[model samples]
Target: MASRTAPFSPFEFLIAWRYLRARRAEGGVSVMTWISLIGITLGVAALIATLAVRAGFRAEFVDTILGSNAHVTVYSAPMEVVEGSGVYSSLMRDYQVRAERVAAIPGVTRAAPLIRGQVMATKDGRSNVAEVYGISAADLQTIPRVANPETALGSIEQFGEGIAIGSGLARELGVGLGDKLKLISPEGAKTAFGTSPRVSAYTVTYIFTAGRWDIDRTRIYMPFAEAQSYFNREAGADEIEVMVEDPEHLEPLAVPLMRAGGDGTLLWSWQDSSSSFLRALDIEDNVMFVILSILVLIAAMNITSGLIMLVKNKGRDIGILRTMGLTEGSVMRVFFLCGAFTGVIGTIAGVTLGCLFAIYIDQVMSFVNWLNGGGVWDPSIRGIYELPAKLQGADVAKAVILSLGLSFVVTIFPARRAARLNPVEALRYE
Candidate 1:
C-alpha cells in the first residue's frame, strides 16, 4: 500500500527557516551571513547617531544665536552726529514711530530700541574689551538670563551709573557686585590731545551668565539713558531690536513689517546675519549623510555577496526541491526571505543601539572627559563643553528604510540566479 505523504504547510518558509538555523557542518548559513549582518548593523547605527548629533547641534546653535540677538534689527546708515543734529533728531523720532508700527505687526511680539558700542572694562588692573548694550528697563527684562532676578542687578531703576556685566567678564576683571569698574570708550569726548577716549567709573550692579561663553566673555549691559549720556549719542538708539512669534520664519515677517514702518528703513534678520555659517553647517550635514549612505551601500553589497555564496552552497538542495515539484518562484522566495531576514534583524538591532547612543551621548562624553583627567574642553579653547544629540523619528526611519531598501535591492540578483538554476545540471554531480 502506497501511503499518502502529508504536505508541509508553507514548505518554502519552513525550509528557509531550517536553512537559516543550519549548522556549518550541515551546509547551513555560513560566516558570510554573520559578516553581512554585522556590516549592516554597524552602518545603520553610525548613520542614525551621526544624523541625531547633527540635528541636536543645529537646534542648539539656532537657539543660542537667536537668544543672544534679536530676530530683526532696524537701523539707518551710520551718520556723523556733527553734520546735522536736526536731521539726527528727526531720524530718531521716525525710528521710534517705526518701532511702534513694527510692534503692531501681526506676528511681532516685542520691539525695543537698543544702542551697541565697544568699550574697555577695567578692574584691579585687568582690562578687557567688551560690547556695551544700552537697553531700557522693560527691554532688559525681555532677555532670558537678564530676566532672572537672581542673575541680574536689583532693577534697571537702580542701575543709575551702574552696569551689569557678564559672569565671564566679571571673573576676568576680578570685579563683583557693588565693585567699581572703569569703562573707556574710544568714541568718547574730543579733546586737545586728539579726542582722548572717554573714561568713566561705573558701579557693578549685577553679574549675569549669558549661558554662552562668547557672550559671557564680552558683554556689558547698562541703562539706555546712561549709555546715551556716556556714549554722547543722546540723539537716539542705534537700532531697534524686534522679537517675533516664530523666529524660524522671521525674514518674511520682518521684511514686510519693517517696510510698513516706512521707506529708507533698513532691516537685518537673524538669518541674514548668520547665513554663511548656517549654509556651511547645512552643507557639512548633507555631505556627512551622503558619506554615511555609501557605508550602507557597501554593507548591502556584502549582503549580495553573502547571498550569492549561500545560493551556490545550497544548489543541490534547490535542485532536489525543484525535482520534488517546488516551483521556481518558491525557490526565489526562499532566498529572498533569507536575505531580508538578515536585513530586518540587523536594522532593528542597529536602531536600538543608535537611539541609546544618541540619548546618552552627553553622559558618554562626560565619561571620556573623566578618563582623560577632566577638562577635555578647556574653557579658553571651547565655547561649548557639552556635546548635543537629538534623535528624530523621521531621521531614524530614513536610515532604516535606506539600509533595508538597499539590502533588499541587492538580494534580487542572487535570489533570481538561484531561481534560474537548472535542476538537471545542479543534481548531476550529486
Candidate 2:
C-alpha cells in the first residue's frame, strides 16, 4: 500500500512558491494586498534601523562620559574637607577603600583630592557662571582629561597658581592664555560692615574644550592648592577622586570607603549621581521600542487580513484538493506554509534593507549635507547632526525574531479559519 502522507521532497519550497504565484495570478493582487506586504517590510526595516541608531548613540555617549569622569567621587556630607589624624590610619585598615593612605590600595592607579563649586568667572567685564573644579596638578591624570592640556594637566603637576577655562566660557568672557580672570565665591566675607563675598583674581594659563557642550560651557579648572586657598578651606579638598583599573568595582569599594570615612564622608558612584540621566535613557529606549513595534504589529495585521482574503478566494481550490484526498491537517499546513513563506521572504527583505540602510546612514546624511551646501552640523533641530548606526548581530537577530514571530502568529488565526471550512460547503459555494 502507498503511504498516506505526502512524499517529502527538496522542492517543497518550490511547490509552496508556485502555490503562492498561482494564487496571486488567479486573484490578481489588489492595492490593499500590495499595501499589506509593503507595510510589513517597511515597518520591520525602520524599527531595526532606528534601534541600531539608538544603540550606537547610547554606547558612544555613555562611554565618552565614563572615559572623562571618575567612576566614583567621595565627599563630606556637610561639604567639609575632612582632616583628622589616625583617620588615614583607620581607613587604611580596610581593603576596599583606604583613606588618603593611597599607597595601601592595590588597584588604585592614581588618587587626587578635589574641590568643586560654582563660581562667577569674569574677564574683560564679561562674566558667566562656571563650575570650578579644583585638582592637584600632580594627580590630574587620575581624573578625566580637560580641554587645556597645559592648564588642568600641565600646571596640575606643577602646583601653579594658574587656572584653566572652558572653551565656551573662555569665548564668552574673551579670556585666553595669560589673561586675568576673577573668581567670586557665593559665600560672603564677615566684617564690621555688612558681610560680603570675596572675589579672588587669578591668571588663566590654559583653555580647554572637551567637546561636550555642558562641560565646555560651564567648567573651569584650578590647582587644588589654589582652590583651597580661594575657598578658605584649609582642611583639604571637598572630595577625593579615585581611579582604578576596574571601574565596575566601585560599588564594592563604596561600602569600604564609607566605613573608612567613619560616618564623616559620603561616597557617590557615577551611576548614583547620574541616576536621572540613566533613567531617562531607559525610559526613552523602552518607549522607542514599544512605539516602533506598533508599526510591525500593524503590518502583521495587514498580513492577517491579506491571508484571510487569499483563503476566501481559494475556497474552491481548497474544496478540489479535499476531494482529491487532502486531509484537513494537510490543507491547514498548506495555508500555514503559505503564510510562513510570506513571513520568511518579507523578513529577509526587511532585514536586508534595514542593515544596508543602517550601515550607510552616515553616508546618507553626509550626502544630504552636501546637497544643502556643507556647513557646521546643527544638532539642535536634528537632535543629532551625525547619523550613527551600530548594527549588532544580536540586535538584528532580536528584531528578525520579533518580526517573524509576529508574522507567524498572525498566520495562525487565518490558517485555522481556512482549515475549518466544510469541504461540501466550500464546493457548493462555487
lDDT of each: 0.80, 0.69
Q: Looking at model 2, report the run of 10 residues with the lowest lDDT sum.
A: 87-96
lDDT tens digits, residue span 279-303, model 1: 9989999999999999989987887
Candidate 2, superposed: residue stretches over 4 Å from native: 1-12, 22-33, 79-99, 102-109, 145-161, 176-179, 186-205, 244-249, 361-389, 422-430
Model 2 pairs whose backbones collide? 137-156, 137-157, 138-156, 138-157, 147-208, 147-209, 148-208, 189-196
- Candidate 2: residue 298 lDDT (0-100): 90
lDDT for position 72 in model 1: 86
Clashes of each: 0, 8
Q: What is the lDDT for 216 in model 1?
A: 80
Where is the poorest 10-residue window by lDDT in model 1? 1-10
List, residue by residue over 250-342, the lDDT tens digit for candidate 2. Answer: 655665566545556667766776679768877987898898788888987777777787788878877887787767666667767777777
Highest-TM-score candidate = 1
